[model samples]
Target: MRSYLFVPGDRPERFGKALAAGADVVILDLEDAVAAPNKAQARDNVRRAVDDGAQVMLRINGAGSQDFIDDLALLHGLPLRGVMLPKAESVGPLGELAEVTDAPVIPLIESALGLWEVMTVARGPGVERLAFGSIDFQVDLGCDGSDEALLHARSRIVLASRVAGLQAPVDGVSVALDDEAVIAAESRRSRALGFAGKLCIHPRQVAVVNAAFSPTREELEWAARVVAACERSAGAAVSVDGAMVDLPVLLRAQNLLAMAG
Candidate 1:
């Protein structure tokens, strides 16, 4: 799941287009992007999108909002791959959501309150992944959305997710679309910081995001050799192509193999 793209739930025309746009997952957004008057339409659209059987995730409104209950009630029986709970501040709301639906919940932590309670949210039963909402988080922190400002929050999400044994936290969207080079650089930076995936705003950004996150040929080759050498050494530390492969290296090789699959 390298490229996770967003699609407005109310726009049926864009659903197939987004999937064909090379996103590993298409998030049908119902909050923030959609207007207050369009909430009902967004819910209806999300329900229809879920029925399409694609890897669709509904980004429901915040828990206390009227739209969330309505969206959940409508999406309960549908076969959505997951639900992205926005502005998650604690485990209580996620637990409530889990009680009603069994789909994997991908919580988006945006506020300071949410960041402080990240561990609690990660410990919840149904969360499969944690995503940082850089824009909202930056707003909450009253700081610019630069790497330095968001670094700690990004690392915090990664640590919290790992502690809960969930997939590595996904990096927030790169708002700049015109500067592909900047996007690539930021994507690489985020990957280096331990984010396993990125949220892309446009289709043109998908390939770059995927390429940045995917293990390179050289990386895979090293991982393969490490795997073979580890097998020979009974998973103990050993020399692989002149480099010493230890437990950390072995685990990385396993992750690479999983990515390859």
Candidate 2:
């Protein structure tokens, strides 16, 4: 999935719109997006969304929050694809969360301690992906929210996801709703840095995000050529084009094909 779009948990009205917007996954956010007074209602709303076949994901509050347990209870026995566990500080929380449900959990590492324990968290069972929580991450670092401030965190999440054989980490949401140019630039940068997908706040931004992440026609052609050459070479590591096509290159070609699809 190259684009994961978010809808506020309390706004069930927007869920269908988000699904129609073409995001591969739709996350009903119960964390920062939900007001405290609406937390209970949001859980019930998310449960209904999950049952609606929207490639459902629930972003629950922190592992230790009062809302987290209630969120898990509502999530249990539902036909959920996954849960996005925000503020994941340790494998212990992930372990505890998994015991309560069977859905795959995507850990959102948003704190300094979470970054410190990322590899451990990624290696935990039921972790299908690791997402960078940029807003809270900036708070954790006490740094201005900018590309420079987030490079290290993005790299760490990608590295941890790779180490655990999980899907490449999703890039954080771009808050500039009016700036398509800026959002496209950020998406390109994330793609260059090896992120497989991006999280989006607005449905209007979903197409742009998906376009930026998807392999271009030129890229797909090149990848197909390389793959065909490898096959013609009898699976040799070197291609007829004088390029070395090893496992990494092969994997990249495969991913290009996947994305092109």
Candidate 3:
């Protein structure tokens, strides 16, 4: 899934529009996006969406919170693609997840403690991937949300996910609602940092994020050529397009093609 678009759980009216926005997955958010007064209503809306059989995921509130407890009740016997737990910092809370649902859990690493304890969180039971909550992370660190400022944090999350044998982490949203250039650049930056997907706040951001994450035509062509060379060479060394096609290079090419598909 290249793009995970979030729609507020309370806004059931927008759920279908979000679903049709070309996102790989639509997340009905119960956290951050919902206000205290509307949480109950949001839960009801999410339940109706489930009853109507929307294929989606849910972003529950932070672990150990009262809302988190209520959010778990909403998951019972529903058909969901996955669950995203925000403000994740420990696996102990995650252990409770096993009793409720078997769906994949994505831990949103958003704070200094969450980043520090990410490896353990990645290795937590039922965790399928890690997600970088970049905005909240910046707020927690009191740092500017620049590529340079967040480089170390992003790299650490990527490494932890890899070491824990989970899927590549998902990056946070780009707040630029109208600037496709800025949005596309941010999505590309996420890919360059080893993220497999990105969290999207707006439906309009979906197309740009999808395009940025997808392998370009030139990349696909090169990958195809390298794959052909690798197959023909079998166990022998080879060159493709004047570039040496070693094991690593060949593997990279094959992976690129698979991703493009």
Best of the candidates, lDDT: 3
Q: How many angstroms is residue 231 displaced in model 2 relative to the true structure, after the best TM-score fit?
A: 2.5
**Cα TM-score of candidate 2:** 0.93
lDDT of each: 0.87, 0.86, 0.92
Model 1 score (lDDT): 0.87
The worst-scoring run of ten residues by lDDT in candidate 1 lies at 46-55
Segments in model 2 whose C-alpha atoms lie over 4 Å from true places: 235-247
Candidate 1 per-residue lDDT over residues 1-261, each given as its tens digit: 888899887778888889899888888888988889988988877776666667687788898878877876876677877889999998888887877889999999899999999999998879999998999999998999988999999999999988889998889999888788988899999999989899888888998898998888998998888888878887556897787877887899989877988
Per-prediction TM-score: 0.94, 0.93, 0.98
- Rank by TM-score, highest first: 3, 1, 2
lDDT tens string, model 2, 93-198?
A: 7877777788989898889999999999999979998988888899888998887888998998888888889988898899978788988999999988889889
Stretches of candidate 1 off by over 4 Å are 232-237
Which portions of model 3 show Cα errors greater than 4 Å?
none
Position 70, candidate 2: lDDT: 84
lDDT, residue 106, model 2: 88
